[model samples]
Target chain A: MPYHFYNTISQLRQNEELVLYDRVLHFSEEDEQLVKDFLKIEYETESLNYPFTPPSCNAAAALWGAKTVYTACQLILYRENKEAELPLLLPVYNNEMDAAAILSADLCLRFLPQALQQTKNIDPDDALIAVLENHLQQWHYSGIGYVLNAATVNFDTVFANECMQQLYIDRVIQKKDMQRAMLPLLQKKITAAMGIYSATFWKELNSDKTHE
Target chain B: MAEDTSNHLVYWMQLDLVHKDYLAQIRHWDNLKIAADEQSIWVKDFTTSQLESIVLKSIPFTHLYYCKDNLLFPKSSLLPVGKQPAFLWTPIERALPVTLQGFNHNFFGIQQQQALRLAPIEEEQKVTVLLATVQDAGNYILNAPSIRLQQLKWIFINNKDALIIGEPVLPVNGRSYWQKGRFIFPVGYAFEFTVLEKIAAQQIDSTGTHLIWWIDEASYCLLHPDVLQPLSIASWRQTISNSPHKI
Candidate 1:
């Protein structure tokens, strides 16, 4: 067999096992109902008033679950406001928050060290990681199950879902390491797609943060 | 054949004598060493040295530009809406260097008909600027009397005024063909409607009716041959008219 064929075979085996494992792990009556409702709305071919599907709903769910695990592991992470309530998170799964997440992740990777080097009072990296975890949880609750379920039915849907899953894994792992390791790959892909590379938007909570 | 030196001259005459072997290499090496030695040397000096033996780039054609807020309707073809006052440009194609420079120098000499007052075109989005056939223009340039030559570029009208301003850059998405060293005034019905709407908005004043200036940085004046002769005369005339108008 050709090298590529073996590589592909191994990848396919891993993916199938992943899908089975995810189904076993995330499946529940509540998740199934939410997925069914979202799918009905999303797959409605003839509806004139369909709500906008958020960007990468499936990917958001995987991130959400992963982040919940991370937060529970970290112990210091906690819900500080009612804003952490799940409703606010649905928008993130809707792609409304994707750009913000991407930008935050980009900035944290870029400026956090410089910020730490200059001042000891703040660890923006921890805050950034917390935000990422929150968004991941939102995605887990919002729409990842629908996408994974849809994947079993449509190959294209599955491909898109799997690609985002791979990207999430890649980005999260790279985030844990450093942007220098992963940003170029993300930038190359994004630039290929959009002709522009952009970081996430950070909403400053306080006006008095010292300028870099 | 006699060379025509009436327009701007971009010629290829003599740049082939530079030594292209060891001398060029040694010069390049020397320059590299000097540049590395001092980073503060001005870029202009560097360019002057780099281009010391380069051949001049040739222009494909010489063009004459006539700009006005309103161009008159030629005496013959008068549509009711077209009869309105408008500024029109006439490009004299393939102008000789002397004539081109002459017109550039003496634009005011060109006589204006009662209907054809020269004014800057304003907000001329998609206006119909004129184009005359070379044969028709040639006859005017070569055969028209001096007074007529001075008035070579004129707008004529039967019932209404003749002058319209610049056309708007059309709401477009693609790269403009005009961007590629070409003229880009609107033409036909769309052109006429744009000119009409813009002219209807002009505020007349004592000096003359004001016109919109659609001067683009990388724009060329495209002229017809007939328009060129008069434009040169008019340009000279304008200078004369403006220079401390003899008491």
Candidate 2:
């Protein structure tokens, strides 16, 4: 599995560079002229389509990069620990949102609110841990499983399958209590993302106006 | 005296075992054990709810059955019985794809009472596949062009019933589409090929054949002949993106 991951990443890196080269080489005279004009701008500007280093980036980032990070982290951790085998990095089993939610609610009640006043909604100390627990280190293995099974086999499919599998297992264990606690937070994030996407979309559509 | 104490301890154990939250109730037995040893007595307060709850949770796949709404869960289909419509009361965790082979094979629906009937037999037949984003086509309804559009719209038709001499175009969630319900097709959908060839040899008929697909989930249909779904194109496009492909 590690070898497969390594090969896939290398192939993806090569493919990304090749695609950008191809696009730049194959552009028509008009597109070439547009590129030249854009280059005249002193500030760095990204191509609307294939701008970033590897060129294109999207949801697949969650699938590929996230999974890669997850697998690599496990391997490195095992090596450092000098363990005979890698630990099944099933984070959700222990540190799911339900556990966090209960802990956070309890903490909020236990600790004085004034102590957290200098920080954002949640205390800075608590926030750092939450970000690590919920976002980065949480359930990477499980998310990958869900993506692989459910989504079309692509860059992100593995992550999607793994994620879903973890969610399913977690759902079984925690039942409705988990969903009830997490839904509001998930909904808020989703809504915020939608807003950003639509705004960017509309801005791109009227990009000609910016030039005018 | 020892025999009497053992019998009394058994009675408390029995009461704890019968409770809804039997595990929590059973924990009380530790206290009972202490009390019995110290006082030369046995006692317990076991609630029926605790034991019953424990029993309910103990059953494997109990929640899965609850999720499936007591539907017969088949691991694999041996007999290719004509497409049976059964609602998945709860959505599956995994994503299902829309592909030529899938159109020939898979069926999906919500867990509800819908009709399954025989398809019309025709010596030569075409299977129509409709591919669209969730935004474009809300839900696709297929019927021969000969059928009145207005009446077809008004009347309810089972998927199999409409697909006479035809296979249903399995709705796969396209990549761009949000993963939500059974109807959301995330992958760009594909219909079956005109010529069915042996899987290994991969031979195709020389003569041209086509299946009409209603694109963008509209009433309109485009006829495709001998062409594999253009998934490679979308993939090549994504290749330009920095992200590595997982699928």
Candidate 3:
């Protein structure tokens, strides 16, 4: 029902504001576990050692995350000329984006990169691109290796949590993503972590010492 | 500016992805055309290496300059990833530092007069850097006094891009060394953090040149960097010159 609701909202099939999952028992136990399964895998890949513990799936988080992804995918793929209403449909998320919130939302948000790619393929000039791109940056754990707009990435929220920062760095190394790795915030820490043997670990870290 | 022979700048001319071809097998590689291993293949004379071009074309590779007295340097760790480049003239399009006479970057391997001779990075493979902690009293190797004379030699020899003066001072503590791969300094004792290099004495200015400039890589900033691995500018640059110019 939540998936249907979000997808309908994006397709102009519905225009309702999102609802929280707290105090709502609309989904089954199996569904909650299934959603948590997605976050678990992404956490492992990211080296997030925060100990994925019991009741990992928060109901409100699952709904918000699923809603965001389902609506985003539909809008990205189908909302061609419907550019003006993008912000209205997928408004900036002003939620408390702590580690728990982000981890919880990754349940369905992880598919964001694939959806974004599909939309880009359909119509690169799609208005929905920016809308979802902003969301992808927020839900970046799922977007690992997806090559988001690295320059615009604000590390304020990421650095707020110790565990998330570590996970972020690990994923960057796991992918050997040079673009994100070279960011000033990450560069210093990663440089110190790898130390003088930087070349031995990641040769791709070299800069193009040439001049224009 | 002084030049370092060990390291070199790599200019990339990306291959079209539409074309289906793998790197050609290596048949011959020399110091002038050093293909020590597949990681990097330094070509001194880009013109005569017609045969080498065949292998190069198939595989992704970067090349360095053949400058004065084999002093090849000016490392580039600043290129963006993920775009293919169109190089009309890969080497000439950019300037080498005045040290080598025509690179945009002012970081010449030379300073005043002390020139540097770089050794090959293809050092003894599989040797890890030793890490030891030194305690002051008994020379427990915790970053001081305990590291024996031998282990210190191994790390300095391997990682010193710049040359060191004389031998390392033995730790004041008793003989001790750890086997982990960390480059911890032997604190407690006075140690100089000089990078290793064969400094060439000089009096020429390494800078203040009316260097030419252009958007050398603006057109290719989006180029993918997978094939570009310039040699480790891992060597050190020290101006032992009486009057060294700022590089």
Q: lDDT tens string, model 3, B77-130?
A: 333443322223223212111235577586775665532222223222322222
> DockQ of every model listed?
0.00, 0.01, 0.01
User: Model 3, B183: alpha-carbon shift in Å?
Assistant: 29
RMSD of each: 31.4, 31.9, 30.3
Considering just the first chain, candidate 3 attains a TM-score of: 0.65
Residue-level lDDT of model 3, residues A13-102, one tens digit each, is 123233333333235555555544544554343322231121244445645677566567555544443568677766665666667676
Top lDDT prediction, candidate number = 3
Tell me the lDDT of model 1 at B180: 10
| Candidate 3 local Cα displacement, residue A18, angstroms | 22
lDDT rank order: 3, 1, 2
| Candidate 1: segments with Cα more than 4 A from true spot | A1-35, A43-182, A196-212, B1-195, B199-247
Encode model 2's per-residue lDDT on B1-247: one tens digit a residue: 1233332211122122223233332333322221222212212232334324564346333211111222322323233223322322211111111234445334565465522112222343232323334222222212111111111111001211111111223333322211111122222432233222222112222223433323233332223332332221122233323234221
> Candidate 3: where are CA atoms >4 Å away?
A1-59, A76-81, A88-91, A140-151, A207-212, B1-247
TM-scores for all candidates?
0.20, 0.19, 0.36
Error of 1 at A114 (Å): 24
lDDT at B53, model 1: 38
The residue-by-residue lDDT of candidate 2 on A1-212, one tens digit each, is 12333332233333521111111112244443332233222111211211112112122222322232333333322323322222333122232233222222111111211112322334444332332233222332223211112222122321233222223332222221222223332324323322333233223323433464
Per-residue CA lDDT of model 1 for B165-231, tens digit only, reads: 1122112222222211122332211222343433333332222323222223323233333332223
Candidate 3 residue A105 C-alpha distance from true site, Å? 2.3
